[model samples]
Target: MGMSAGYELSRRGLKTLLIDAFDPPHPNGSHHGEPRLIRHAYSGGPAYVKLALRADELWRELEEATGEKLLERAGVLNIADPDVYSYAGRFQDAADHGVRIEDLDADQIRFRWPDVRIPDHYRAMFEPNAGYLYSEKCVAAYKKLALHSGASLLPNTFVKRIQAERSFVSVFTNTEHFIANHVILSAGAWFKTLEPFVRLPIRSVRKVVGWFEPSVSSFEAGTFPGFTFASSLGSYYGFPDIAGAGVKIGRHETGEEWQPGEDLVPFGAYSEDEGDLRKALEAYMPDAAGKLLKSAVCKYEHTPDDHFIIDTHPEHSNVILAGGFSGHGFKFASVVGEILANQIELGHWGRDVGLFSAARFSPISP
Candidate 1:
């Protein structure tokens, strides 16, 4: 969010300073993991569809501007038992939003993707234009563009404290103190560290993702599509094998509470996560459960209601807080960046951002 916002703000002639605790394209944050799925059939709500559509446009724009391949149009399949989850409602929402989607029953899904094993009661929504974003590549491209647009980027800079005043905000780093007219707190898991100045209902949870070698060639990127299946077991999402990296799979809602600045689970150490994904694969796509190639742990800053909070600080309007993505926000990074920039410049985003305001979590007055 910070990188894309910096790029947008800098391009809009605002002197932007993009600061990160780690280097660009690092795996410490949520934007790691080679590819993140992007789809317009948002189960979160209809509000997300607009942002998603805008993000798709911006992603293509960035790719055209940088001449780098960022988004892969490999399609996405959302499969779920109609009785277990609201797949029907989600499909209707997608269609209502004018998104191109194909409704498929279990038989049709099995016929279309022979590798997948769908039960007779399952239904699917196939979004042909949805795909995955090369996450690291997207960040690198945004950073490069931000720099090219005259934005100063400070990597590996640890922010000790932030003092938000009526006039400006003071950010004290390990080396120096920088003051800006407005400050955006896009620090993913570390967002809570800004204490009394910016209090948010965001929890950082450690999530594990695994890459597995598929037994069959049908799971390759060209033939297979990214899938999110909601079942009685749990909600699981996976990507097709891209660049021979193997098919990546992970559970959506299972993660341990995590805190920033603490020791994290080492990469490739998530044996249990791999097992969970293996079970999902064995049930949904048995042929894809070949071998667990590798696993990595990342953090998801979740909101109380699993919705995003993209609003200004209640005490200090000049300080914008954009966190609590809840594990499903990477695809909306482009649009979120634009919204943050718009919030800073125009004082309003002209969209129905009320659903994401911090005021929703504010204490009620008697």
Candidate 2:
């Protein structure tokens, strides 16, 4: 995600410096998972839908610049009961934002998707433009472009401390220190340690993604699109069988509590979370959830609400804070990169960001 920001800054002729504790496109960070759902009509809010629309445009621009096929046009399936969030709230977002959406009943879904066997009472919202973004490749593409644009990138370098002042900010790594006129803190999970200097209400929590084999061979790229099932339990979303990795599935709900650099990253299947998830798959999508292949664990830096915090520091305008994406921030990384660059250079965003401000949660002045 930060790769795009660094690339955009470099492309805009800024002397950009990109630092990451982990290497770019490495499996250590949240960008590991191959595909993430990109839906225009958001269940989160109407403002997010607008942001997503702009993001879609930026993503296409990035693809053209990098000459890599980063985004897939497989569409998105949001399944839920008529009373659930996908049906009531997300449908409202589509209607309000004037995005194209198709409502599908159970019979319609079976006729269209063929493989998906939804319950009679359940329904689905189909956004034809929604699809998956190739995450690691996107990061790689941005990093490549950023390096070519003369940006200094330091990988496997830990940011030990940061000291912000009135005029400039001093950042200290494990081995080196960088003093810059402005600083943009886009650290994913290790964002809280710098909270003393730049306070933002963010928490890092553990999350996992599971891959399951389908009972039938209908889980191909064209046969099945990425889907999210809204249940009384929570939102469970999954992608199609891209690159024969079976189906990648994960819940939007919070996982176990975790502190950065302290929690154990799980790869093998376990009983605690997998048991319940498997039961859900068996009940809702038996053909697609029959075989549990493996699971990979990651961390999410979350706010009290699932919205992003993409504003500059209230106390110091020189320092920008952009952590707390929860987990849905990857899809918007293409445009967010530009937003971060704009915020750092202009000290204000040209886009509408009223819903993403940190001040919305409290009576703090920006």
Candidate 3:
């Protein structure tokens, strides 16, 4: 969100200054993990579908402008047992948003992809336009574009304090202090550090993502698509073997509670996560069950409702806060960036961001 917002704000002739604690395209934040899923049939609601559509357009635009392949349109498959969870809402959202999709039953899924072992009670929704985004490449592209558009990106600069006044905001870093007419706090898990200035009900959880070598060529990129499955165990999502990276998988609903500034568990430290993933593969995708090659820990900053908080500071309108992405917010980063830039320049973004307002939370006395 910071990179995209900085690019858009600077393109609109605003003196945008982007500050980050670590150099971007680094593995410290949630934007790591090689690839992130991007789909149009948003389970969040129809509002997200709209944003994702716009984001899809902007991603293509960015790709054309930068000549970088950021989005891979292999496809996305959402499968779940009828008794576990119904994906009817996903299909409905796709229809409402004019996104092309195909509803398939377990037999059809099994016939279409022989490697997948779907039970007879399961159903699936396939969105041909849905795929994965090269997350790191997207950030690098956005940062490059932002710099080209006259934005100053200060990396490895830790922000110690942010004082938002009625007119301008003063940001104090470890080394120096800078002032700006407007400020955007897109800090992921670190948003909690702003305490009295900006308060939101957000929790950061540690998540583990694993990559396993596919036993067959059917799980490769050209043949297989990105997929999500919900069952009695939990919800699992994964990608095909892209660039020989292996089939990356992660359990969406289970993770350990994490906080910023704490030591992160080293990659491959948790064998439990690997075991869980292997069990999931044994049930749904037997062919994908292979050697667990690598795994890494990431953070998810979630709100109570799992919706995003893209609104202004309760006390200061010059300050914008964009956090609480939960686990499924990266797909809309492009549109969210535009919205943040719009909020800073126009005092209000044109989109229907009422669902993401900080005002939805009870006022915290500053």
Candidate 4:
């Protein structure tokens, strides 16, 4: 999010400084893990579908600007029970947005994707144009573009404190202090550290993602599509084997809360890290649950509403806070950055940003 905003802000002739606690494209944050799904017909809410569509366009533009393979058009499948909120939300939002979605029963899903073995009661919404983005590369591409556009970066630097004033914001780091007319506080998982600056009911959690060897060849990137499934058991999302990476899957909800400055206990810290993922795979795609090849532990920052908070700071208008993406924010990174840049310059964005405003929650009192 910071990198994308930096690129947009700098390219528009605004002196932008992007400070990261660690070098991005690093697995410490949520933007890594190879392929991240992007569904236009969103299940989160209708407000996100428009952002997703705009992000799709910007991602393509970023690819053209970077000349790198940033996104793929390999389609995505949303499977859930009829009464499940995800299934109904996705269907209604898709219809409202006019995004073409193919309604499929369990049989059709099995016929097209033979690995899936959903029960007869389950239904599916297939978004053929939706796809996944190369998470790390997208960051790298944006970083390069931001640098070329005259954006300065300070990696491996932690913000010790932030002093938001009426005229400008002072950002103090472990090494140095910098001041700017506007500051974009996109702390990602470490957002809790902001304390009094941000008190928006945001919590960071330890999320585990795994890649499993598939017994079926249909799990390959070209043959298979990314999938997000919701059932009585739980909500799950996965990606096809890209570049021999194996079928990547991760549970949507239920993760341990993560503190700001703590090293994750790795993927195997608990048995469920793999066991839970295996259970989902075995239940839905038994053919793709052969063996666990690898797994990763990342952070998930979420709002109470499970939606995103991308607006200016409540106390300090000069500072913008863009976070609480929950689990489904990466694909919106491109547009989030664009909107952040817009917020900094125009003090307002083109779209109805009420859903992402910080006013919904009171700022933490120091």
Point to the candidate with the largest lDDT.
Answer: 3
C-alpha TM-score for every candidate: 0.96, 0.94, 0.98, 0.97
Model 1 C-alpha lDDT per residue in residues 1-366, reported as the tens digit of each score: 999999999999999998888898898899888799999878767898888988999999999999999999999998988878866667667777789999899999989999889889898889999999999999999999999999999999888888878999999998899999999989888876667667788899888888889988989999999999998989999999987788899899888788878888775466566778889998999888888787788899988998888888777779888888999999999999999999887878757887888888974111
Q: Per-residue CA lDDT of candidate 3, range 144-189, in tens?
A: 9999999998999988898877889999998899999999899997
Judging by TM-score against the true structure, name the best candidate.
Answer: 3
- For all predictions, the C-alpha RMSD in Å is 1.9, 2.2, 1.2, 1.3
Badly placed stretches (over 4 Å) of model 3 are: none
lDDT (C-alpha) at residue 70 in model 2? 91
In angstroms, the error of model 4 at 258 is 0.9
Q: Sorted on TM-score, highest at the top, how do the candidates line up?
A: 3, 4, 1, 2
Q: Across residues 1-366, which tens digit of lDDT does each residue of candidate 4 receive?
A: 999999999999998888998998788889878889998987657788999999999999999998999889899998888766446657778888889899998899989988788889888889999999999999999999999999998888888888988998898887788989999888888887777656667888999999999987889998899998888878999999887778999998989988988878788889999988999999999888977888888989988888888877767888888888998899999999899898888878767778887777764434
Q: Candidate 1 — which residues are off by over 4 angstroms?
A: 267-271, 363-366
**Each candidate's lDDT (Cα)?**
0.87, 0.81, 0.88, 0.87
What lDDT does model 3 reach? 0.88
Candidate 3 displacement at residue 201 in angstroms: 0.9
Instruction: Tell me the TM-score of model 3.
Output: 0.98
Clashes per candidate, residues 3 or more apart or on different chains:
0, 0, 0, 0
